[model samples]
Target: MLWLAFHFRALSLEVFSRGAAAPAPLVVVEKQGSRTWVIACNDAAEACGVHVGMAASAAQALADGLVVRRRDPSAERESLAGLAVWAGRFTPSVSLAPPDGLLLEISTCLSLHRGLGKLLKQARSGVTEMGYAATMACAPSSHGAWLLAKAEIEKAIREPARLGSLLAALPVALLDQPPAVVEGLERVGARTLGECLRLPRAGVARRFGQALIDELDRALGRVPETRAFFEPPASFERALELPAPVQAAEALLFAARRLLPELEGFLSLRQAGVQELELACRHERRDPTIVKLGFVKPTRDAGRMQLLLRETLGRTRLPAPVHTIVLRAPLVLPLSASSGDLFQARNGEADGDLLLERLRIRLGKDAVHGIESAADHRPERAWRPCQEQNHAAAAANRHRPLWLLPQPLPCHDGRLQLKSGPERIESGWWDGGDVARDYYVAEDRNGAQLWVYCDRVSGEWFVHGVFA
Candidate 1:
């Protein structure tokens, strides 16, 4: 199987933000024996003479206003697992390469994503979008891809035969061998894999142990390697903490965009779409501000979702600075692929649903609604407003006017010229409000058509509706 590997090079510092630029010169340090050493540093810190592997004390002395944070292995693992979930949109077979790497078996998925080149382009951009700096490489074997990515080679090796020659020059220290074996190999002038590979195989295996030989065989695609693949989570719920508190809606959206892509990936994997989303903005001392977004139909388009979210945020007023944001899409329904762009322009129809959704987000839920025909014969109780329109049935009478008046106005039929015969609507006797009328189509001198009905009981004529 063709394996693609992603080595998260800056994971030591990036777990805090993936790969977001820090506001100041920052470094992530870890304890090495009794002294703390910088495991990762940003360009800002590097410009101030602070580099990875430098002692924390020396790095602090070299840079002014430097921020030093301890490396969080737990966060790094969690971030890697989250990335595996995100990568599920590309390939189903994903395996975690612990500390800072991942392996994806993509032989069956290359054509599904167009090609290797296009797939790699999308993968690179996806990693960047998730705020991670990763080196990617492809090979015939999982360990081969992982080793190449760790060495920062960043090239796709198609043939298994070429893997040995390509991996030869890489440092022996890059291997997953024990420290003592690596030290022993280095002591014997075998600093690179090529040098160690040229040595007597039996002598090396007998001295260094068979595990190293087996590891080399795996990397070279000579032996089969079995790795547990990552299984995507059943539901999509993620939280991201900001580097600093943000009060503006735009800043909040900027952070929220990162989560949208992952949500899209999750939905894409499930072949479903989400109709609602809940965004919770966490504050230090106040309750989280919950912003609920809705759609006219289920959708998986990240771009469209972001557009509506931006419109919604414009009208929302945050009560306090938000320290963290959580995005949740608990329920997803099966959606046909053709329905993904259902809200888009169709048959030259205006984007009315989008307009309605935007208006509901801007105004209020109770302000904008649709109308449905109720089961009543009385003109006043014939229709009612509803949140969702029921298109199963329409008014039984086809001659009803599009525009109906709220209350019928009493008028004289002497000045009106009757056109159509009277249509009787004598139902609703079971209720207190009953209408016993014969509706007729009439025309005035202004050439406007009107709906006028004569009460059978009072013999009084009234204008009820106007035809558009």
Candidate 2:
């Protein structure tokens, strides 16, 4: 069935603002152990003036007793991601709605997981053990359960038809109405959903607009709802949490070994390769770190990447031990195919290309350059510098060497051995300095294939480019 996703942002943000849920005198700290206390009474916590958005310092000043610590967003996100991964075991369709929220399709999974009650308990325990409290609801519709889970008077409402009545007593706030509409409804003594439902639809629509009716319609299962679940990519990048915080480079490389195979599998599934990727880690008592690598061309060979990364890992020293890791690549391309004639063709030469690209990332863009054709007859002006784009296209043009020296070198004297010539070209006459050159192919003394041309009027020879 559908599930209600509850995000206790107020509670999480308290931990984000401070390390723990600090104790307030008016708040009931149910003793779990000698030093372990759970915030048992939420009302008492609120009664002690521990409201959301109220600064920890302010709460302490107001209550004279409070606990606090630095917030850890990375740890929180990691925990959420881990929970999302675990939830996948129940349903393939899992939506991580962020900051302590999850939307799972339990319709198909309900029977598999032993009904709604058992699944809810499992989810609750899963999150609870991960260090977060969750109130769950499963209904025929997602919105209906979401309302139940978020209600102040919390209880599971199993029967679908009985859901409307359960929501009838809920506050207007639960309807997701604008603050002004809630205020207006409160003024009119319409404190419940049932009371608002009793009002004329036309009047409500005219006064509060369609937002009120829309949310109600969603709650009642009159509208269609869909969740966009994150799809697993063909080639994946993953970082593992260290068993303990790690500082030595070898330790980080060892952890990456566990993820490399999975990444390779993901690439194989997509029939693609990992030409570019990154590895990130969070060190002990330090911020998270990132190490990105790329290839000259697309490749799926985990062994190659593993070796390269191992080398990099060995070279780099950590300032502090690492606690977690993250790997990512903004783009991934297909592997190149090579031809039988090694020197003449580059049907499959992705590895070299990807390697060079990785070097460019480590170095800078200008560090690498390729030759591109220019529409000009002058030998030097015929070719221009360009960066690699379509790997396939670049491979196909491998028979054509890219580096044509910036300026054309002067060719042999007077009588030129022009293989092919007189492809006449003339331009820029009206603007200022005009050109009149006849392009040609010629053989040099060293027997190198050179793109040469002759100045029609001046009768000068210049070597423009090289042919493979």
10 residues in a row with least lDDT, candidate 2: 14-23
RMSD of each candidate relative to the true structure = 3.3, 14.9
TM-score of each: 0.87, 0.44
Q: Backbone collision count in every prediction?
A: 2, 18
lDDT of each: 0.84, 0.61
What C-alpha lDDT does candidate 2 achieve relative to the native structure?
Answer: 0.61
Which lDDT tens digits does candidate 1 get at residues 128-166?
Answer: 777878999999999989999999999998987788898
Question: How many clashes (backbone atoms < 3 Å, residues ≥3 apart in a chain or on different chains) does model 2 have?
Answer: 18
Best by TM-score: 1
Model 1 residue 192 CA deviation (Å) reads 3.4
